[model samples]
Target chain A: MKEQDDKQIIIHVDNLVKKFGDFEANKDLCFDVYKGEIFGFLGANGAGKTTAIKILSGLSSPTSGIVEVAGFDVYKNADDIKRNIGYMSQKFSLYEDLTVKENIRFYGGIYGMRAKLIKERTHELLSRLEMTDYADKLIAEIPLGWKQKLAFSVAVLHRPKIVFLDEPTGGVDPITRRQFWDLIYEAVEDGITVFVTTHYMDEAEYCHRVSIMVDGRIAALDTPDGLKQQYGAGSMNDVFLKLARA
Target chain B: MNRFFAFVKKEFLHIFRDYRTMIILFGMPIAQLLIFGFVISNEIRDAHIAILDHSKDEHTQKITEKLVSSGYFILSDELKNENEIDACFRAGNAKLALVFEPGFGRLLEKTGKANLQIIADASDPNSAEMLSNYTQAIISAYIKDLNMAGYGNKIIRAETRMQFNPGLKGVFMFVPGTMALILMLISAMMTSITIAREKETGTMEVLLISPLRPIQIILGKVAPYLLLSFINAIVILALGFFVFGLPIRGSLILLLAESMLFILMALSLGILISTVAKSQQVAMFISMFALLLPTMLLSGFIFPIENMPVILQYLSAIMPPRWFIVIIKNIMLKGTGFLFVWKETLILTLMAIAFVVVSVKKFKLRLE
Candidate 1:
């Protein structure tokens, strides 16, 4: 993994709370993601990880909190934050009926990228993924692994400052998951911050820092080694169990 | 503008590449037009009938001849008695039976009133109702002719004149109504489904996370549908004019302008539906039950609104297509100008604005 010692904070959240009626989906959340660092948002099912990500990405609003993304207020400057961030959802986000090139071009164009730049990036992305032959192929014809990778590439086509990946490797093989992480490492190398959510502990260990949510609050927030040492556990899975059990 | 076009192009790809959507968007209107124009018409011609005459007198014979010669009915058989009436109907040889009462001519001469029983097969109530109506009209005309023969004074003659549609062609009624239905389905249902599909596949989140404004996203999604539905309206009008000889008696430009207005209204309705639906299936169900069925049933498309119960008539007044069909009929059939249809146009404009405002508000709420 590339070193992320710049210490420039990109995302700042303080005491964020989101409630639906009487039920709180996220409660008293506080975290910060640094410049060019891979911040893993780890949680079990219904752990409010998705809810926190939504608030940070400007997809939803918090009931009460101070949340800043890419140096802009989530409440007042959501559009500016949107322009500076990329999002790849857990569900496949590409138009399955559209060709791979069309999908990339559409995302690039919507981000106000010039036509010439979109063409250049299209060439570079397809070549980087070794998918030059599959540019004209419909997304539905591609394998799930390549599709997720392509989705990630499309998400970052405009080179946003930060990218949010919500469970980008949910149902992929081990090799593909590793390859997806390699892409994240490459993006981080380019000084693009990554805020990703996952339940995979092996993937959690790859992050510079991790925050594990239990119920609707962040139960633990630290580096993987720090968390494991603090809990006297061998792996992130056990650390999560020890924290969650407590 | 470039981003908007790019988004719209993506939408077009989603539409044209999917054969199911293509069939529904293009093929359904033509099929509905052909079916409604030729097969499911209300103009009765050569309907089968059985006659049971207890009085073989001149008056009863004259009435039967008048009914058959009016070209609305053909005598399939002559029944012997009341028992044969049910047999004739059960055999499906006739949809209607005319029974002349005993001493019908004598009763008419003495009391100036005669009795005849017309029994219609009521299984399919709409057709049965039409059959009974046509039979009554024919019998009434015969009675009028009999009075004109100087046997008695003619009582209260009504010189009814049917303007525009002198032949009362069923095509005239269906063309306007079908246009309303087709435009609403293509604009509202298709746009809603496309948007809901994006939501289903999670591309909607990607969209919301983009720099494009929510209004831009919505307009981008519906712009292609607007163009295609406009083309569909023109095609339906051309077919109605050329194939069925339906007329555009008013200004063609005004007709098109009104159609565009209705399409806008329907697209706004689509946006509203998409706001409430989270999945493609749910969107489709809501569109079908909420928009499509109401546009068809309560829009005065096939049924006469004035003849419906007063409560339903009041309900139909709020149906957007009801006003749209009336405006289209006035422009295409009645040859009326803007003065006659301005109220309908204003109503449709208000509805379009209302839908757009509601959907935009709901969409902003969704984003928050």
Candidate 2:
């Protein structure tokens, strides 16, 4: 929404390269995510989207790159970077046996939040998500939509500077995915930057900016409308197809 | 520290909520102790035997009465002839048959010689050998009594004494072995599976991405198991003491300290396994095959290490439970102090350190 020069950059990646043994999972990737914006990372399976997200999240070390998150270097200040970010994967990260309230409390406690703050925030979160009635219910008792939303909420419970979502809405219905994006918009409104990776083309349109990776390289990156206009396509899907064909 | 406690608390919740884990943590130690103590024992009690006494004299009746009343044998049947001895054993009604061949008390008084044959089933060779040894010991005692009464010139006699455990109670050996086995199972297997569960469910990624360090996560995962395993060890020791009459002849503190050390070693080994295992099933498999089987077979828990083949003996030298069993036996049965068991303790200590070092080295800080 704002000019790139005026906005603050929360994540900065320059010539990031990652290799595993003789295979390169990511190659010469370059990108930046501004604070308080939804950045979509789009790629088909094995395009190395997850690998790049892992490196940016401090979950994996880049073989060679200048990657920074929340102004912390990926190589040296990984722990600091970890403290400033949150993560959720497609595999429903909530402890199934733990109640919703307990999961929230546990995540908050591990993030070193004060007991009083965690308690207050848990109450606020349960009500805000309209899950106050389900606070004492185990995560297994909740529906898939609620579980995804709860996972996203827990990821941002510490008010992290950036939350990484690795296919957070993989199997959810379109209606629920729309609701999940609403939550993401709410998080951005609260000044939390979101970096999400997905294969859903329609989800790409909702992002303030998007990067399409192909064969371990970023082939295209721009705002959804800007990419459509540049590629002379009607939708992000056609733009992706054009790039793939190229 | 607060975060660590929170993580440990969550681990405890996981263990307590899972009934299977609850059964394993509490039920296994007691069940194993009772099974090893009451069942699967070497000591015999109330063994049935058939007596064929041709003499029908006072000495023969007295010896039969002595064997029955010694609490080792029961007079199950009176055989009519030598032919019935075979039938009694074939029917599985008797484990041994005692035959006295046309022995008159007058023969012993005049010539100082009597013929008595003790036929054992020998199908169960160990028990058969034991029954024969017991019968021989009682007969020899009777002969010695006769000599003491000046019935004849002195006769040659062999005496054997069982030291430490004079009763030869099988529980003595099993108590230490079971303690080692249960501690290893709970500490190593449970911890590994729990860690693998995190990886399988993808919670590990979230935890890794959090402010918690990898060391903190590992310690948090292991802390509750350590406490639970220590409690399990105490329960086994208590059962051994009160139920089986196994003595803590040495310093209980030293014994418990050694147990704690063994527990540390098992916990570290568990962490190492988790580092390699990608799923809960793989972790469980590795724990069962790599830990449980070896502890049962190679640690001299059920089999003697000395009786093993040359290579297995060498292999057992690296088994942590083997050294632990030795240390426990030395303290519990031999009543030895730290000075006597320092070598075994040092070995266990070194193993614990090595496992911990290797685990930390193998534990991935990044999700490679």
Candidate 3:
């Protein structure tokens, strides 16, 4: 039970400071993503969500921080973090030239999946998502909704403990976005912690817990209901607008 | 092994699907070879020449016939006098004027010597020099033949046989050089563009975020080009032998192994370029200027590296294509064995190792 409980703190970011030259992008920021929860990290365009995500993704080194993901430190155990986490970007980041199955296999292959398992998982995945019909189609030929689902599935195909989604629903239709949230909910239900950064307040409401970044620090961090009730607002959208304007 | 094969299969599918890549890889190199071979030449043929004969004797008439038959010079006009030489040149009707001094046959018979002053246009020195040299050599040979026929007692003799490339076809030189260039372009430039394209389309991030090892990602990206360049090497060799009449005088296995080594070196260079480049455009620009330009210009493909300035010569020496050109030329044109080409092979092997090391280091740094 203790071993499994240790997995609860899937990601624990401490007093993280990221700087580009003299400018501090993420300063004295701290947050934690519990296991099996959809945690929304929200910020405006320049509010430093990307910089923090970059540091966590092992794409860039943090200026100073104790960044941990999937029970491994970001600085020292990056290889472990790599194995333990998956990322989906704002771009529906599947290989357009590749067929849906090939993209899944490619992603799975990268994570060192066995050929048999990759093939098996691909079959299971396509059938589950009802993407079996589009499995042989090139990613470009598929509809946008299917591409979005494929990108999300590919990100988590390796069965990582946590998935980092950097605006995974950008340019996606509202119907697909809602469907996308259902997929996230399904992953979380399977004990895969979801750490997502988004500009959408409605999406923020769907997250079990949400943190809003304003100017480089976490301005608000709580449940959607807790934040709205505390801020005397009826919705997450109003709470965000009031805080952003402030 | 299966994973590697699967990765290679995916790479081939990517290449086969992209029509532009198929054209650039299979279509361009052969076209380039044929275009440069049959369409262009360094040998000057039928260059304009004006004749000035003081004595229009049988000897001079026979000499003109030999010169005309040699195809080195076209007799543009008969020069009336020495004064007309300048006018003929000024009128741009001739690039060279031959002046046969007065008493040409008389002097040759009595004094055993005759002067043929060839005043050639010095603007393009190489072609002019070749023209003059051909004229002199042909005239000397004709005189020698005349002497052997008992017309004269001069015993100066010369015999020549063109060794490997008897017909002296341009394809003999260009075949190996084109193979070097095309393989390098496909392996280095095209591979970099493909890798950099993943970064451009935002797919690289997703792949990296997945469970795929960085090594597998790189191997997957480069494997297709490796197979392609190898097949291209074979195609060029077959075309050179069957179509263009070039021969492989040395061990075929050694040539193929060395060609494969050179391809690896080029692909490593492509990987190195992709590491520094942020997007496909940057990758392509770097591959063109940093790899393709050096591979083509510095490798002695079109220009002799020996004739370049000392610094450029040294720079060219470091280029893998330079070593590859020497190796392939030795194998194909010179028909030299492995003993002769092992040093070049070693150089290419070391270069491939160095490129892979630097690129892997850069890739690690980028991830950091």
Q: Model 3 misses residue B111 by how many Å?
A: 3.6
How well is each residue in A1-246 modelled by candidate 3, as lDDT tens digits? Answer: 124356467788999999878999998999887888888999899999988887888778898979988888888888888888889888668888988988888777767788889899899889989988888899989888888888888888878888889998988889999999999988887788888999988898898888999998899999899899989998899999889999
In the order shown, the candidates' DockQ scores are 0.76, 0.84, 0.50
The RMSD of every model to the true structure, in order and in angstroms, is 3.3, 1.3, 3.6
TM-score per candidate, chains pooled: 0.90, 0.98, 0.88
List the candidate 1 regions with Cα displacement exceeding 4 Å: A1-6, B51-70, B78-86, B96-160
Which digits, one per residue and each the tens of the lDDT, describe model 1 over residues B105-213? 9988878877889999888787788888888877777778878887695334445456888777899999999999999988999989988988888889999989988
lDDT of 1 by residue, A83-115 (tens): 999999889889888999999999998999999
Worst 10 residues of 2 chain A by lDDT: A1-10
RMSD of 3: 3.6
**Model no. 2, DockQ:** 0.84
Indicate the docking level reached by candidate 3.
medium
lDDT of 1 at B226: 93
TM-scores, chain A, per candidate: 0.97, 0.98, 0.95
As for lDDT, the candidate ahead, 1 or 3, is: 1
Q: Between which residue pairs do clashes occur in model 1?
A: none
Expressed as tens digits, the lDDT of each residue in B1-368 for candidate 3 is 55556666777888999999999888988888777667765655788988999988777888888988877679998988888988888888888888888888778778888887898876778767877777777788888888878886753555555677654466777887888888888888888998888888888776665445678779888888888889988988888888877778788998899988988999998999899888888987887787777867888987888799999999988888888888888888888998998888898889899989998888767665
Model 2, C-alpha of B78: deviation from truth (Å): 1.6
The complex in candidate 1 yields a DockQ of 0.76
Residue B78 Cα positional deviation in candidate 1, in Å, after optimal superposition = 4.6
